[model samples]
Target: MKVLVTGAAGFIGFYVSKVLLNKGHDVVGLDNINGYYDVNLKYARLHELGINKEAASNYNNVCKSTYSSHFTFVKMNLEDRSELPKLFETETFDVVCNLAAQAGVRYSLENPETYVDSNMVGFLNILECCRNYGVKHLVYASSSSVYGLNKKIPFSTDDAVDHPISLYAATKKSNELMAYTYSHLFKFPTTGLRFFTVYGPWGRPDMAMFLFTDAILKNQSIKVFNHGNMERDFTYIDDIVEGVVRIIEKPTTERVQNNELYKLYNIGNNNSVKLLDFIKEIETNLKMEAKKDMLPMQPGDVERTWANVDALIKDYGYRPNTSIKEGVKRFIDWFKMYYT
Candidate 1:
């Protein structure tokens, strides 16, 4: 199948695109390559996908991959009104995996408009294109952050996510609502996967795993948020890509719930690991103790997140079995190679 993966240069998006290409699917990757964290990292991801950095950096131009003939990269933003529609009309994609968004819970506190433009307005554009172009399946990324400050031990898709702690989460929840409306009205299948704290090789620098590793390696002090009182369902990248690939192939039409073509599931490791334990794994892998700066929890941060992926397991036989120790070791190996 021909697939369009938005934010193809992104952490999850990059891995997802590579998996799709390996499966012999014709893939087109799109990203604006914004300077949110490091544009070089984004370019490096694209380069790994066989896209020329010079060609991919140019806006609105599509570059064929030197790595795989089945893969292509486009330098485009989701909010582009004119260009986005034209690309959709021209390509006529069968499935669209909308992974692009302005991510980060804490960053939303400072740059709220970026969330509005990318997550909300940009998602609307994706919905419209899917509706107009006769696309079959629309698989988009959602976040566990939508669970907000709920005291629920293991977050289920059935749990109430009405109260999002941050604008970033709010926009993700809004994406689900928008997709459901499109699914109900247009009769197109839309699936939203609520991802947990996904970490592995090529992970984002802003995330805990990368930050902690970088700080430790550089001999800088690492901030232990909430004074080492936090837990996360840190799902491995390979498991996430597998679950996503399965979901992409089996759209909502195959597994209809509540008579709606829209469905949601938590794509995460069911086991939640403590924050300090996670940090310890990094220290073990790097063989260096971190200078710890214990601090209060920042705003828009949750104390714990544990995913109940029973729905995903029941339907898709999705099981995330990667342990934190193994996952951290792999990440540290990649970090050392990439940064050294």
Candidate 2:
């Protein structure tokens, strides 16, 4: 199958593209490589996929990977209505895994327009392309943050996500709605996977796992938000990629829940680990204790998040079994190797 993986330079997107290429699928990776975090890290991810740094950093140019002949990459934004559609028309992608977006809840508070442009407007373009082209399945990245301030113990798909505290979450919720509409009107098959706190090697620098690990190694103080009173269903990277691959491979055969080929699932490790405990795991792996600076919860932040992945399990036999200890160890191992 020919697949178009948006945000292929991203952590999840990078891993997903590699997996698909190994499975003998033709993959075209797309990313603007914005300076949201670190462009070097993004470029390094592309480098791993055999893409040249010079070619990947350029705009609108397609670079064939030196790593895998089956993988090609384009440096472009999702909001580029002109270039995006041209690629779609040329590739005629069978499956589109739309993982591209301006991620980071706290960052959204500072830069709201970025969220709207990428997550909202950009998503509309993807829907338009999928509808226009003969794309079979459209699998997108949603967030557990959409659950917001809900007191529900285990956040489920049935739970009301009407109250998103952060602009990032709001845009994500908006994407789900937009997907539903496109499916209803044009009969486009779409799946939105509400990912929890995904962590592993090649992870984002802004995330808790990466932040804590970096600070600890440098003997710097790590910020513990909510005064060490937070819990997250931290799913491993491999498990998340597996679930996404399964959904992409198996297109929605029938209408789901009165909706025309629209499906949403919580792709997460069903277990929520306490923040302090998660920190302890990182400390254990690095063989060093982190200098902690307990802080109050920042605005646009939730106390806890726990995903009810029963639907994913039932539908796709999805099992996110990587423990916190193992995941942290693997990340630290990669961090040491990469940094050194």
TM-score of each: 0.98, 0.98
Lowest lDDT 10-mer window, candidate 2? 251-260
At residue 196, candidate 1 shows an lDDT of 98
Worst lDDT run of 10 residues, candidate 1, spans 251-260
Clashing pairs in 2: 50-67
lDDT of 2 by residue, 1-340 (tens): 9999999999999999999999999999999999999889999999999999998878999999998889999999899999999999999899999999999999998999999999999999999999999888899999999999999889999999999999999999999999999888888789999999999999999999999999998999999998999998999999999999988887565555455598899988998899999999999998999999999999988988888989998889877889888888899999999988
Error of 1 at 232 (Å): 0.8
How far off is residue 47 in model 2, in Å? 1.0
Please give the CA lDDT of all the candidate structures. Answer: 0.92, 0.92
Cα-based lDDT at residue 65, candidate 2: 92
